[model samples]
Target: MSPAKSRHLNPKKLIRSKWTSASPRNKEKHFIVTNIIQPESKDLPIDLIELEAVYSGRSFALSWRELTNTQDWLQGWR
Candidate 1:
């Protein structure tokens, strides 16, 4: 059976949440939310999400909406 749809999430609550990439790169598939980049100005909105690779200790930022795409990301460690 196909996996369930990823949830409509709140970025503010995603700190420390785990994620798994649908496709592995350099055998690194596991990741975790390390930080939710704070909006620099009150007039701005948060748009970037930070994740750390559990395998390599490398961190990167991406659009938070990308997490909702099941084709590229899974909701938990898998």
Candidate 2:
């Protein structure tokens, strides 16, 4: 596997992790992982996660890999 593919990501551990968007919408920069949508079977990989805006109580779903993009998302709140 390539370096990125070899990297380990524990989906169950992602819950409650904080995040910050590089480009804030409606001035909401801070967010948290509120929910992790798991696959129907454990053998399947995780595909989506729900992020809640700390300032607005808004939530949205996104592909988990999007969080790995430093240009778009910082791992912790900033």
Candidate 3:
């Protein structure tokens, strides 16, 4: 199976645990996932979130469909 298909079916759970300083040469924030959820878990996560420091010249954004009337986490940013 393709990675995209697997991701759509059930996103692999990942434990995001640290942040690195962004530099002039590197505009994107680098994230390290510490661990991954087992295959037998329940509903997959809606989206994987990443925290970016705007002061460091990096901004991360997320947009999602209304899957089952879930609450929005980015309301304050809008």
Candidate 4:
């Protein structure tokens, strides 16, 4: 068997054991702290101001251009 397939055979446990150990209030505080620390993506308006494409000989060719300041352009791939 392949290494990747063998890894999937292992049983997985998803219990939050620490939650039972901690008090109810402590769990809430933990969640709040974790949420604050978690990185969030800011939804910024993008202006698709200009789009230019060239097609020599094809049935259908589609190209797109948008105005965005994001470091990585391909948002859908992510």
What ranking emerges by lDDT with the best candidate at the front?
Answer: 1, 2, 3, 4
Question: Of models 1 and 2, which has the larger TM-score?
Answer: 1
* Comparison by lDDT, 1 against 3, better one: 1
Report the number of the highest-TM-score candidate.
1
> lDDT of all the models against the reference?
0.89, 0.84, 0.33, 0.18
Going through the candidates in the order shown, the clash numbers are 0, 0, 0, 0
TM-score of each prediction: 0.87, 0.82, 0.22, 0.13
Residues 1-78, candidate 2: write the lDDT tens digits: 333323245777889999889899897999999999988998998999999999999999988877876668877877
| TM-score, prediction 4 | 0.13
Deviation in angstroms for 60 in model 4?
A: 15
Misplaced by over 4 Å in model 3 are 1-12, 17-26, 32-45, 51-59, 63-78
Runs off by more than 4 Å, candidate 4: 1-46, 56-78
Model 2's TM-score against the true structure = 0.82
User: Which segments of candidate 1 are over 4 A away from where they belong?
Assistant: 1-6
Weakest 10 consecutive residues of candidate 3 by summed lDDT: 66-75
Lowest summed lDDT across 10 adjacent residues in model 1 is found at: 1-10
Please provide the root mean square deviation of candidate 2 (C-alpha atoms, Å): 4.2
Q: In model 4, where is the ten-residue run with the lowest total lDDT?
A: 29-38
The candidate maximizing lDDT is 1
Query: How far out, in Å, is residue 37 in model 1?
Result: 0.4
**Superior candidate under lDDT, 2 versus 3:** 2
